[model samples]
Target: MNSQVFQTPIEYLKGVGTARAEVLKKDLGIFKYEDLLRHFPFKYIDRTRFYKIRDINPELPHVQVVARLTHKEILGEKHTKRLIVHAQDDTGVMELAWFQGIKWAEKNLVIGKAYIIFGKPGMFNGKAQMAHPEIEPYSPEALKGKGNVSLQPGYNSTEKLKTFSLDSKGLQKLVAILLDQFAREISEILPQYLLQKLNLMSRVDAYRNIHFPENATLLYEAQRRLKFEELFLIQLRLLKSKLLRTQKFKGNIFGSVGQCFNTFYHDKIPFPLTNAQKRVLKEIRLDTQRGVQMNRLLQGDVGSGKTVVALMSMLLAIDNGFQTCIMAPTEILANQHFISIKQLLGDDFVEVALLTGSVKKKDRKIIHENLENGKLKILIGTHALIEDAVQFQNLGFVVIDEQHRFGVEQRAKLWRKNTIPPHVLVMTATPIPRTLAMTLYGDLDVSVIDELPAGRKPIETLHFYESQRLQMFGLIKREITLGRQVYVVYPLIQESEKLDLKNLMDGYETMSREFPLPQYRLSVVHGKIPAADKAFEMQRFVKGDTQIMVATTVIEVGVNVPNASVMIIENAERFGLSQLHQLRGRVGRGAEQSYCILMSGGKLSREGRIRLDTMVRTNNGFEISEIDLQLRGPGNIEGTQQSGVLDLKLADLATDQEILLQARKIVEDIFARDPQLALPEHQVLHYAFASKNAGLSWDKIS
Candidate 1:
């Protein structure tokens, strides 16, 4: 088997000239011979059962029959013309028709000749017929040949490809040609010993059976082998990247827990740290002590005390004589962090400053000067912190809040701020399912703070329909009467003619009418509002100046008002699970019990109902995330759609967790026993890795 053949342009393959090749490349991304080979079937139709013409019904999915073309004719004018052929078996008669490819059908059909037909059955004016069915001359010897299976592989193709005779059936023919000519040239990538241990099919047999399986058992085995191989390669690559980083990068060792960390942990802390928080801090400490640049993903549910853990990690860096910074996705979050951290470190001997786009020139100049001269110990800001003028004296550690909001390239800028790339701890409030975490952040060590801080109550979630609006209003009024503020969130800021939703403006007006202005003050905030105005409203709500704050999802991440005890989400079914969870998190910050009221219309879709039910059933973010993955799939998850590793063809992240775990385990075992994969038995794996990542470098910190 030669690698060069796989790399050959797809246009050079037999039966695929330049015209068809361009269509394949443009539509399906099949530019090379190997790409075509890897384009697996989406489904397979069983052709083994031949149905009698009398038994065919419109309800049947697809059926195959052996019949003869008794009569053929062309009917209608130019655009409406069609070729109709009457076919009959010993039992009954059926009609075969073609509208688009009339000329080809007329030229190919032989009158009174027996043929095998396969297609979906349909009813047309009380007669059974098949539209544009696949017709092949009947041959008993071909059907009886060894290794010939009665399963027909179905592929995905665009309408444009159908015009050029590259539909599913045409594509299947081309694949058969490729396999007939070059199936033997396909190389076996896995070692023989591993294949024997796993009892997996050989590479060539797997490829052949995948497209044209001999039987149901062979197809199952083929799919299993290919899925295992794909996941194995991805896990192996990520593990290798992590190993290479540890071997190549040298981190500044933070070997001491000095006055700053010890004081904050023992005396200045407001409450006792949860066991989850302590565990995460210990993991970060070990990474910093190992002298290897740490790339860790800190996952915690909303209100899980991730910020305290982040601040403590920063204190550890400051204790070891290094400046630290925390980068947030939005200015509101940055301001919140700045204010909260300042209050937590009250009267402590640590200097902190905030830098953002809205800061005045004078303040920016002083902040920049202090940062460059080692006067500022901790800097908290948004994207402005990565500006060229902002230089650090010794930036040893960095924390990214809501890491998914920032692009990978933007995050990389912070890494270059120091001579030695600083240790990175990217924190996210959105819980990632275990399988997604393994694939998306496999190159980085992971830590999860799975519990909330002390005195925090699990938010009580409730579902209400449009008819229950009065009940919801009564609850809000009661909460406001108890000296608690309320947040009323809407999905859409403006009214859409296409969607029947309760917009923000309409909700605000209703609230104003329900609780009049003189006694009940209501604040409004949305994305369209000016930044200063939005800040003013947010501040008023935080200070309990307003009894009700009407807003949109922009308040999902930033607002942390402790006195806000109620979250009423209008059109709650319109939002995703993670977003609903985040909005629910806006409350339950105080020791008092909190409630999240989900209001939806009478007409609820199944998926929408599941989302709301899941929210009401559990406050655990991890449990909600797993259900979210199953419902919406991995591609729609917050940060994983753009990851290159998620471009899986044969494996599904939601349903294939068992296979993924097995692949990861095997990869780990291989690396533990043979670091370099230098043994003779593993040469095949080494070669596959080299060929797969020929021009790529695994040096970036994820």
Candidate 2:
């Protein structure tokens, strides 16, 4: 495996000179050859054969045609260099129009000459026409319809690069240079046995085929191999990091059985803790008291008493003469935490303060002074608590709510606040698939609150078609009349015919007219609204002051309105399963029989139908997550299409669950026998593993 870095800048790459490099660097963030090598295409184009002009469909975006040039004419005003050529085959005749590149195109389009043209066909002057189609001079054999382009690579380039004559084919030629020159040095990256068993193509071969495939099977194979490699690297990185943290690092151990927890359990709280809560508390107590830093993920379904458990854990820290800080992703959530903890620990002798980005200067100064002086024993805030200005006297424990919103860097920053890394507890309401959890958070220990609190009923979820709009509105009216608030959510802010559904603004207006709350007040919230305004509107619903709240997914994460027993998701099919679960969670937090009405306005795709059906069939977040994983795959779970979280080349995170389990077993055995993969039989694997991690800042494959 080649571990050496390529230091050459992009300009020095075979075809991209200084001018082309300038365009790439300025427009696409490509400053080096390495960047170009890693810039994977978003999509591909297939040009197997060209169709006759008469067979063209104006509605289609991509089309190919082959015909002979029968006539050529330059028309339009002096300022317009429009060249029009009439071409025809046995089927029909069509016009070829080139607006500016007349001289060059005309020279290539001689009368009686045959050529192949590839581009979108359109209607002009009530006839078929192709504008600036990619033209290729015909060969005698190709003119007979025998030639075919099995696959064509389309490189992602900006307009500036295109105008400069640098297109997909041009970029492909440059990459070919890199691959050809480095073939020998690019030692195979995976073990020979695993590669053969998985039927994955070699890295060198995969790269070539990804850009220029000889057949459909090869293309599929190439894509599968690349996806698997990416995913494998990610899993390896996560597992390796986890091993490093647990095996190499030490943490402050907290004892498992303590009088503080026992006393609080029997004397302090008014109600008994739920079984799930007790189980999670025990796990946290063990992890924190193990004398090693606790990096654990606490996953709970909606209304599973997660907050109470979090509060209990924080109390344990406080009892140990250590200060605890809890961070929520939003100001509203932070404020909610402040109030909940203060109320939960009423007269328990723990100081708590709320710090947010919007804190007034005077209040900020007071909080800052208190935090620095250790007077603020427990702090609850948004990202403001992470700012350097905020100091803790003895920050022993850290709790992060809605942990998915914070990235690795942000969590690390908070973890560094104490002299010793604080016992960290991260919580998330979004239930992730087991495979995804393993890959995304392999470094952290996980705790699942699988059961809801005692006496709590599951929220009833239903799906409604657009035709049932009137009935759904009536249901909401009845629910509001029954003293329960309702949330009407829209996926968009304005009407977009491209996406068949009511936008937030349009829905707000229509809802205002239909569900006229003359006797009841209503509030509106969306992304474009100011945060302060959104927070205020959310407060209205939270306080039971607003009868209905027309909102977007903005409230999908933090806002908790127990009294809002009804959730009417407009265009519910547009939302993902996990998102729907989160929104449904907003309700069902109280002791009410909450209902989630999923309303979709148009025909749902198979996946969309599955999402809505899953929501209606079950209220368990874990089940919904498995459905989501099966439908959407793990591409965007890390939030970005280009994220490097699961950089697998051959493995399918969703479908190959059994394969992953087998691989885990194999990895464990192999490590036990030869920890560094130093055996002769594992040489292929060692090279493959090292090859995958070569040149990467952090090893993707553990």
Supply candidate 1's per-residue lDDT for 11: 93
lDDT value for model 2: 0.77
Worst 10 residues of 1 by lDDT: 693-702
TM for candidate 1 is: 0.94
Model 1, 1-702: lDDT tens digits are 555677778899998999999999999999887788888899988888889988988999988899999999999989889999999999988999999888888999998899989899998887779999988888886476232237778899999999888998889888888889888888787889989999999988999999998788999999999888888888988999888888888898999999999989888999999999999999999999999999999999988888889899999999998999999999999999999899899854699999999999999999999998998999999999899999999999999998878888999899899998899999989999999999888888999998888778889999999999999999988998899999999989999999999999999999999999787999999999999999999999888889899999999987889999999999999999988998999999999999999999998899999999999999999999999999999989987776767888788889999999999999999989987787888777765555442211112122
- TM-score, every prediction: 0.94, 0.76
How well does candidate 2 match the true structure in TM-score terms? 0.76
Q: lDDT tens string, model 2, 1-702?
A: 444434368887777788988998887777755566666655667677667777788998788777888999999877876999988889988898989888898776789988777888998877889998877777766544233355667778777878877677667677778767654554455667778888789876776677667777888887776666665545554555565576666776655545655666777776677777888888888888677888888988887778888877877887777788888988778887887777777765567788998889899999889877877778899998888988787788899987777776887888888888888898888887888777666667899999887767788988988888888988888888789989888888877879777888888878888866567688999888898898888887888888889988888877777788899998898998888988988888778798999998677789998899889999889988888888888886635334455655345678877656655555556566765556777655533444343332222234
For each candidate, the alpha-carbon lDDT, in order, equals: 0.89, 0.77
Candidate 2 worst ten-residue window by lDDT: 691-700
